[model samples]
Each structure stands twice: as structure tokens, then as C-alpha cells.
Target chain A: MATWLEGLIALVLIIGGVFLLIGSIGLVRLPDLYTRLHGPTKATTLGMAGLLLASSVVSSITQGSISVHEWLITLFLLITAPVSANMIAKTAMHHDLTPWKRTKGQELVDPASRQAPPSDHHSVKDGKLP
Target chain B: MLTWAVIIVAILICIALFLNLWRLVQGPSLQDRILALDTMYINSIALIILYGIHMGTGLYFEAALLIAMLGFVSTSALCKYLLRGDLIE
Candidate 1:
């Protein structure tokens, strides 16, 4: 019974690891900034959740109880990953970064694309960039 | 069985980590490097959690949580700086 459960946990871990690995590969290989942002934000978040799930299971089995803290991390990650991705995407836009040629036409869909508004220019005027 | 699985996953995650490092090093743009750093820290959390599972120790959980918190803060700060041209008004 113990070994069976361990095998199950291992299966979860393997899937999580593969997700994480693919996320990293995307981070390295994706053509442009905006497109690359999609990879780590989604896949890695799911991967982390899987690993945390495995941890929760292992704790329950070995320590004879469920651990709530891994779940906390899981929730924290789920909330923050998309938020971080949003911030990063906005920042990239503020920098006027371009998309890959293959993935062009973002300017048509996203009015907020590359061009900073007049108000954004005012902020830059008031603040000194490091 | 569990031990072998953990080792194999760890090895694969390490390869992932190195790929992240390569992106961090060779990334063409500042945004790309920042993204690389973000992904790397997240990978670290996965690695730590896997280690804790293998050892059956809850201690590493705290470390993973801390990394997650700090990583988010750092990424946000960088974004702020990039977006506003200044971190603080």
C-alpha cells in the first residue's frame, strides 16, 4: 500500500517536472518578449501546483497528517503568477519592446501597445531613471 | 521507487535551471533577462519542494515560501522601475 501511494506521488512529481522543464525551454526559445511571457507564467504555475500537491500528499502519508503550508504556497503562486506576468507585460510595453515578426499585429489588438500615452510621458519627465 | 523518481526529476529540473541560466546570460533584451530571472526562481521553488518531498522533511517548505514571496517582490520592483522610469516618486 505504501509503495503504491509512493508511486502515485512519483507520477505527479514527474508531470510537474516536465511542465517546469517545458516552461524553462519556452523562456529560452520563444521568439519575442510578449510571446515568451505566456510560457513561464502559465505552465510553470501549473507545474508548481503539481509539485506542491505531491508535497501535500507525502506529508500526509509520512507525517500522518496533511500540511496546510504547501497549499498556502500553491495559492500564493496561483494568485501572483498572473499578476507578475501582467506587470512584466506592461513594463515591456512601456519600454516599447517589439513582438516577433511571426507574431505581429499586436498593435491592432492592443491599443496599449508600445506607444506610451501623454500621461506616461509626464511621469518620465518628473522622475529620473536609474 | 520514490527515491529514483525524485533523483530523475531533480536531474531534469537541473537541466531546466541551466536553460534558464543560459537565457539569463544570453537574453537579448532587459525584459528577457528579467523574465529569465523570474522563471529561474520559480524553478528553484519547484526544486526545493521536490527535495523536501524526497526527504520527507517540512523544513524546506518555509524556505520555498520565502523564495516565492521575495521573488514576487523583486519582479514587481523591477517592473515598477521599468514602467515608471523610477521606483519611487
Candidate 2:
């Protein structure tokens, strides 16, 4: 019975590994900044979750008790992945980084044009666009 | 039977790693590279857990946690740099 359980845990780990690899590939192969961002943010999060789940399961089985640390890491990964992606995208916008244009799409509007109105946007509200 | 299953999973993970490596090397922009790095961080965590299983030691779990923490910090720093033009002002 114990051996059976170990096998199952190992299977989960393998599957999780596969997901991780796929996420990495997307990070490498996607074109354009925004498009590439989608790959790692979405796929990699799932991948990590799978691996963590497998680890937690195995640890629980081996130690005869629940393993919560792996779960915590998984939780952290899920929450941070998207948030980090957002931060990067927003920063790209702030720094005037250009997004890739695939098909002559409106000549790629200036990043400044997408700025929100300067009312509650800035914290100080010192008559400056924040 | 269980051993067979574990072996199969290991194979799959190896394939996935190859795919991710391709992305890491082929990324055309700096942001993509950063994304790849983030993915790599997650992968490493998973890899560490698997290594723990293989070695039958719980210590690798601690290493995985550390990797997770470092990954988050590094990615945050990179994102900040990407946004503000400097990691520290």
C-alpha cells in the first residue's frame, strides 16, 4: 500500500515537471512583449502548483503527517505570478516600452495616450499627472 | 507498478524542461527573458521537490522554500527595474 501511494506521488511530480517545462518554452518562444508575458504568467503558475501539490502529497505520505509548507509555496506562487506580470506590464507602459505590432495596427499609439485622466490617478494631486 | 509510474512521470517532466529551455533561449525581448526566468524559478522549485523524493530526504523541501522566496524577490526586483528604470533609487 505504501509503495502504491509513493508511485502515485511520483506520477504527480512527473506531470508537474512537464507543466513547468512547457511554461518555460512559452517564455522563450512567444513573440512580442505582451504576448510573451501571457505564457509564463499563466502556464508556469499551473506548473508550479502541480509540483507543489505532488511534493506536499509525498511529504505527507512519508512523514505520516500533513505537509503544509509546500502548500504555502504553491499559494504564494499563484498569488504572485499574476501580480508580477501586471507590474511588469504596467512598468513597460510607464517606461514607454513599445509593444510589438504584428499587422500595422493603427501605427501603434503612444503609451502616453493611454494615460488615465489626472484626477485621482496621482496620490499627491499637486496638479501633476501621476 | 508504482516504480513504473514514477519513471513515466520523470520522463514527462524531462520533456517539459526541454520545452521551457527552448523558450528561455529564443525569447526576443528582455521582458520575455524575465518571464522565462520566472518560469525557470517555478521549475526549479518543482525540481527540488522531486529531488527530495528521489533522495528520500526532507531537507530538499527547505531548499525549495528558499528558492521560492528568492524567486519572488528577484522577480520583484526585475519588475521594479523594468518599471522605474532602476532597482534602487
Candidate 3:
């Protein structure tokens, strides 16, 4: 039973590793910043979750006690990855970085207004308007 | 049997590392580099866990945790710098 359990855990780890590998590859191959972020945020989260599951299984089997460390890391990664990506995208917009647009063939759009600039967009009182 | 599995996972992690390395090498913009670094951070954490399994030591878990913590801080700092050209206002 222990051996079988180990095999199962190993399978999970391998699958997770493959997902990570694919995500990294997507990061490289994707054309634009927005498109690239899609790969790592989605794929790496799934990959990390799988690896953590494997770790939890191994820890439980070997030590005969449940290990919660991997679970915590997985939870943290899931919560943080999307927030970080969103922040980066927003920052890029705030700073006027170029975004890859599919229809326009890489035309540079104003970072603050990827569409139209708001007349009241910049407000000192609200502190919420950028 | 477990040993073999661990070795396989380690090899796969190495491949992932190489993929991220490629991004680091050829990324066109600063943000791309930051993204690559973030991905690399997570890859290292996974690698450390596999190493822990191989050596039968739990010490590496602490290292993994540290890397995860540092990774978030570093990425945030980079993002902040990219935004305002300063880490602190």
C-alpha cells in the first residue's frame, strides 16, 4: 500500500512539473505582454497546486502525519498570482507601456487610456482616479 | 520507486528552469524580465521541495518558504519601480 501510494504521489508531481514547464514555454512563445501573463497566471497556479498535492501526500505517507505547509504555500500562490498579474498590468497602463493588440497589429495606445481618456480621470480629491 | 519518481520530477523542474531562463535572456521589455523572474521564483520553490524529498531532510522546506516570500516582495518592488521609477515615494 505504501508503494502504491508513493506511485500515486509521484504521478501527481510529474503532472504538475509538466504543467509548469508548459506555462514557462507559453511565457516565451506568447506574442504580447497581456497574452503572456495569461500563460503563467493560469498554468503555473494549476502546476503549483498539483505539486503541493504531491508533497502533501508524500509527507503524510512518510511521517504518518498530515503536513500543512505545502497546502499553505498553494493557497498563498493562488491568491497572490492573480493579484500580482493584475497589478502589473495596471502599472503598465499607468506608466504608458505598450500593449499588444490583435486587430491593430501592435499599435501603441496611450497607457492611461487604452480607449478614451476621461475628462475627470485625474482627480486629486478622490485619490481613486488615475 | 519513490526515488525514481523524485528524480524524474527533478529533471522536469530543470527543464522548466531552462524555459524560464530563455525568457530572461530574450525578453524585450523590463516587465517581461520581471515576469520571467517571478516564474523562476516559483520554479525554484518547487525544485527545493523535490530536493528535500531526495535528501530526506525537511530543512529545504524553510528555504522554499523563504524563496516564496522573497519572490513576492521582489516582484512587487519591481512593479513599483516600473510604475513610479522609485520603490519608495
Candidate 4:
């Protein structure tokens, strides 16, 4: 007889694997960099979180002691994924990489605030704070 | 049943890892390759965790944590290098 604990762990693991697959598919299928950025950052992050949770469940059930350490991995990933995605996107924009026509890429660049776009930052810099 | 699920999930993640590998090798831009590498490491962590589960031990957690740290730092450095043409100013 399959235990409920085993069934739950299996379900979570399968779901996590599916999401990882979807994220990779998105990476390959998406045409533009900005759109492509969404693949690894969002879907893959969640997928990893799912897998970590499943691991925690399995460990706690079998060893009769909760493994709280795995949660640290999940927490670290959740915090970093979005930040890394943001930094990578900013770098892409600095390179003047074009976005898809359907994408309103300019909205990502706030005109009213922040320093000049990375491309112009060099030439526009007077070594003065404005 | 749990073992079967682990096998299936591992296979799926392996397929995903290969896809990320393809992108890393056939990248049209540096950013794509970096992103692919980042995703690849993340998938590997999943694989490691699955291995730990299969072994019925949490010992692999340390290795996964190290991979996570190294992957993030590398991705950030690569992206920074791309943006500024230097890793550190």
C-alpha cells in the first residue's frame, strides 16, 4: 500500500519536474531576450522551490526529524532569482539589445528617474551628481 | 511508488538540463548563454536533491548549497562583466 506521505512527495516532485521542463521549453521557444528572461527566473525558480519542499517532506518522514536546512536553500533562491533576473535584464538593455515588437520594452526603462541607460552613461557622465 | 516518481522526475529534469545545455552552446548572445548556464546549475541542484532523497539521506544538502552560491556569484559576475566590460571597477 502506498502511504499518503509517499504519494504527496511524489506529486510535488512530479509537479516540480514539469515546471522545470516548461521553463526550459520557454527558454528555447521565446524569441526575444526580455521575454526569454521570464523563463528561468519565474518558472524555474518555482520549480526548484517545489523540489526543495518535497525533499524536506521526504527527509522529515523517513528520519523522523524535520530537515529545516533545505528551507534555507529555497529562501535563498526565492530572494536571489528575481534580483539576478533584474540585473541580467539591465545588462541586456545596456547592450541595446532590441525587444520584440509586441513588448513595450521602453516601459521597463523609467525616464523620470535613475541614471542614464548604460550605453549613454559613459558619454553623459561629467563626474557630477545630478 | 515514490521511487517510480523519483525516477520519472529525474528523467524530466535531465531532459530539461539538456535543453539548457543546447541554449548554452548555441547562444545567439552572451546573455542567453549566461542565462542558460544559470538554469543548468539550478536543474543540477534539483538532481542532487533527488539523489539525496533516493539515498534516504540529507547529506547532499551541503553540496547543493555550495552549487547555489557559486552559480549565483558566477551569473552575477558574468552579467556585470557584460554590462561594464569589466568584472570589477
- Taking the candidates in order, what DockQ does each have? 0.77, 0.59, 0.70, 0.87
Best by lDDT: 4
Displacement of residue A53 (Cα, Å) in model 3 is 1.1
In angstroms, give how far residue B62 of model 1 lies from its true place: 0.8
Give me candidate 2's TM-score against the actual structure: 0.77
**Global Cα lDDT for candidate 1:** 0.86
Off by over 4 Å in 2: A2-7, A95-130, B1-22
Candidate 1 wrong stretches, greater than 4 Å: A108-130
- After superposing candidate 4 on the true structure, give the runs of residues whose Cα lies further than 4 Å from its correct spot: A107-130
TM-score-best of 2 and 4: 4
Q: For every candidate, what share of the true interface contacts is present?
A: 0.88, 0.70, 0.58, 0.88
Query: What tens-digit string does per-residue lDDT give for candidate 2 at A1-130?
Result: 4777666766666666566666666665655676777767787688677767776776687788897887878887888888888776665556566666662332333423365443434474655536
Q: Report candidate 4's interface RMSD in Å.
A: 0.6
TM-score of each: 0.89, 0.77, 0.86, 0.89
The alpha-carbon deviation from the true structure for residue A14 of candidate 3, after best TM-score superposition, in angstroms, is 0.9
Q: Per-residue lDDT for B1-89 in model 1, tens only? A: 88888998899899999999999999988888889999999999988998898777899989999999999999999988887788879
The per-residue C-alpha lDDT of model 4 at residue A84 equals: 87
Candidate 4's displacement at residue A38, Å, is 0.7
Using lDDT as the measure, what is the rank order of every candidate, best first? 4, 1, 3, 2
- Candidate 2 collision pairs: A21-B16, A24-B20, A25-B20, A28-B23
Higher DockQ: candidate 1 or 2? 1
- Superposition error at A75 for model 2 (Å): 1.3
Q: Compare candidates 3 and 4 on DockQ and give the better one.
A: 4
Model 3: runs farther than 4 Å from truth? Answer: A103-130
